[model samples]
Target: MERTRRSTIRSLAALGAAGLAGCLDGGLVGSVRERGGDGDESDESGDGDAPDEGRGPPTADGSRHLAYDLETLREESLSGGVGTDGIPSVENPTFVRIDEPTLIDDVPVFGVARGGEAKAYPQYVLVHHEIVNDVVGGDPVAVTYCPLTGTAQGFERGGTTFGVSGQLVNSNLIMYDRATGSWWPQMLATGIDGPMRGGTLREFRVVWTTLGEWRAAHPDSLIMTDETGYARRYENDPYGLYAPLGGYYADEETLFPPLSDPEEGHPKSVVVGARTADGAVAFDKASLLVERVLSGTLRPSDEPVIAVADPALSTGYVYLNPKNVTVEPDGDGYRVGGDGVGGAAESEGAVDADDLPLERVLAFDAMWFAWAGFYPETGFVGDHTGAGYGR
Candidate 1:
């Protein structure tokens, strides 16, 4: 997919670890609290289900309010799983799936999709919470994630380069990060209906195959990250069809993290810059150089935090999953609309699939409110900060 020259540039400018340190620090502490909370109340214990210890006070149900489990959400086909009829209603009604292991540029990655018809989520393009909470129908949908590469699968959908935060939120096909155990749920707001419409065949597997091929080739790409950081730069891509109507920047760049042993702790010393076409350039004339990592150009390092290429996912109109129907062949094609959150959210004024602009989309305030109440841990952190947080 051709990235909007402007948005691409903005993405580079937006790259920084300022808030990242805070987010990551808070995220880790939050993970421990939430996960620990689960063992005390619930029986299931896994990364996806790991409770947010740092969030809100425990609900009566004791669920940490997380989207999905990272460790336990094994890849499974929806051939005969239970339908959405029995699933309880959730504020953020995200769909979860574990897919077959596929090679990308010889690197293996897992599949994880979240959200539905009302939103579109791009993996790595817009890095915010490890979990994604989007609106589907009118309900809140949270998606838990873990990804091998920092980012993966740069693709086009509906003629737009969907490298934005919420473009594929409701699309069927989603991707996962193998290393981090992250799941990326995708859906298109332009078509289909609600969460009940979610099925394995049409929505899930289609994207799996597309990203598998891309991962088999491109391995050294940079996924999107938080644009609210100090050392970051975010541009607007005018030609970015997926970007909000106003357009975005291009020729984005950022200083890469210095290489170091995990035990030694990486220093914020080195400076690296990555461009859409020219590729990555390091200030240090010659360190270990890699090209098109996502495209699978070089030998992967033992180092966990290595830069890789973006998985090239396909673009075009994606069909929404039909709701409350048996999984069988239908000559008339799949039906659209159902009781899923996508439909409900659309009915309300929270968000509009057809009209959300890129500028608004890129604005942190606009997107943050969408899932402000995600994991209980986030609530806990906010409270802690309000009470006087420690560095």
Candidate 2:
């Protein structure tokens, strides 16, 4: 029976809604004593305090507001059926410099450029193992991806590592820090359960782009290899392909019901989302790239911000524009500051889209449904409603 299941995943052209849950099965997990159970790794108990910085993964100073009650999310969670560590994380990951002449140009990679250190984690490889624990720029970090939500994210792993909790909330991956057994949903990035409840992770940007584009931008970049010590086929994507946009990714139906049903936008359409202490906001990625710039405000607070597209990496960056500066696309970069904000004539300069003069807000790409599910109040900027932030 297991053999047939393995064959089905290995041979399927694209995954359907029903095949989503079973794709990670068919293989027995290794000894639990190796990594220990979720409880065995616990280092603290729930005390209504944040996890100690020295013992737990580093957390953000301020927690992002959650649209739902913590207890409500805990009750709504469902088991993914792949017990803890079933989809293991890549610890002591191996990497090699990606030089020219490689045939893997079109492959998609999650590129992270931190403090001049550039490294990429391939989608095909991460599809088998959702998390890769490695050090980038001398900081222990965890690079994560969720196939169901089509989201990729980065977090600082101070003294400990993270693993899959074998659970799903709003069709997103639930990551548990080994130090406190805190469950952090990838999209929310807040601890929903365990000793670290109410804690928020310090996040970094992970650019989603093709290998060829990344290599072109960062010539000295290194990419993770498929030597994760796990016995699995990395070539076969369990979900589907991103380039051709096939399989479960392109499907309109979600495997599980969403917590909040958004009235507008496709469930699978990609949106660049940002969250601050004030509130969360999302911009249509496709529109932002073409238009090169989109402006919106973080909810209730209504703090002004703008989304600038980086054509080089095929990603977008959100910047806080309290001054309401006008940022327009030049030849290849952006022209910022003029009589744009509040009708005030300000100093103008040319800057790269990724390196705007304003303060940048941490943002990442997420499926519309996942963003809406976790942040129902998120202000969406798209073609229908022109985001009139005075830009």
Candidate 3:
């Protein structure tokens, strides 16, 4: 009888609505709503207070505006199976040294290091729990992932925590702060709905590369383990496989309609997007492979930024151009400077390639449709000539 129930659940998972309902019934979906009243009333007091209104934010008008079009924000498009905290955030996560036998090298991982502490978050685990609230170098950070957009970014939490709002703005994760109950869209980094509306969060740099690449770059780094408090199928990816055919990743059609037109690159084309105070630019991953390195001054800003690709990992990174820095293929990894930057196993300290002295602007990998939807006027660089991924 137990085996029959498990089989039924898997079958429903493949069937959409019925699958979602089953997840809710099994308690896989968290139903915790905002405590207190409506999430309005300004939180300028900064005492981590909840509003005395109802759930959600005040209606948007000229006084309160969103970065994206309010009309395009389809509230009904939210993934209902997962409620607040349904996909739990790792509070006090454990990590293992890079050389630890538990982790395989080829699996993709999001790597972030600061001061001296480096940590790797595996995609397999992030596929289950999209947010991981952990502290590094004495700073509170939230590492987030949106499988739909293929984006992994880190943000400074400002003494607060973030949770999955179970909402998607343009198929991107919508995060809410536990303290203010404000809804923040992951890619936009702005609080769209709540007292914190129009406010932005500070972002940190996180490299999306293979575990082997990160391990080779930061030998002393720590890798997040599978010991999350929740019982999850860490090995099973609900979105399909990574290599060869990337499941939804390999599809050109977006799961939901985007605010921007899909006439540019294919919907799922992967691009390394960089944003500055002035403007934004996206470098096609496949184009970077052919060019090896692409760099130039992004319009609006005279300063230059460079994009480099790691073909082996099918990942790329964007950095503010450093003085005399040229990214070239260096064995299994890419070197940022004339002075060789070795792999993590041989490196003495955290890999500084991703952290040049210049300010590391906020950048992330995104599906073309998602990035273009958020930044329609964004300038695109690179040859986009190949067949492109997903399609």
Q: Find the 10 residues in a row with the least total lDDT in model 2.
A: 34-43
Off by over 4 Å in 2: 1-54, 340-348, 383-391
After superposing candidate 1, which stretches have Cα over 4 Å from the reference? Answer: 1-19, 22-119, 123-133, 142-233, 236-391
Q: Tell me the tens digit of each residue's lDDT in model 1 across 269-333.
A: 11111111001111110111112111111111111111221213321111112222111111212
Q: Residues 105-148, candidate 3: write the lDDT tens digits.
A: 76888888776898889988987888998988877678999877
Q: Is candidate 1 or candidate 3 better by lDDT?
A: 3
Q: How many backbone clashes does candidate 2 have?
A: 0
- TM-score computed on alpha carbons, candidate 1: 0.20
As for candidate 3, its clashing pairs are 37-53, 37-54, 38-53, 38-54, 216-343, 216-344, 217-344, 250-390
TM-score of each: 0.20, 0.85, 0.71
What's the distance in Å from true for residue 78, model 3? Answer: 3.6
Model 1: residue 94 alpha-carbon error in angstroms: 17
**Cα error, candidate 1, residue 251 (Å):** 19
lDDT of 2 by residue, 273-337 (tens): 88776777899888888898999998756889899998888889998888887888887888887
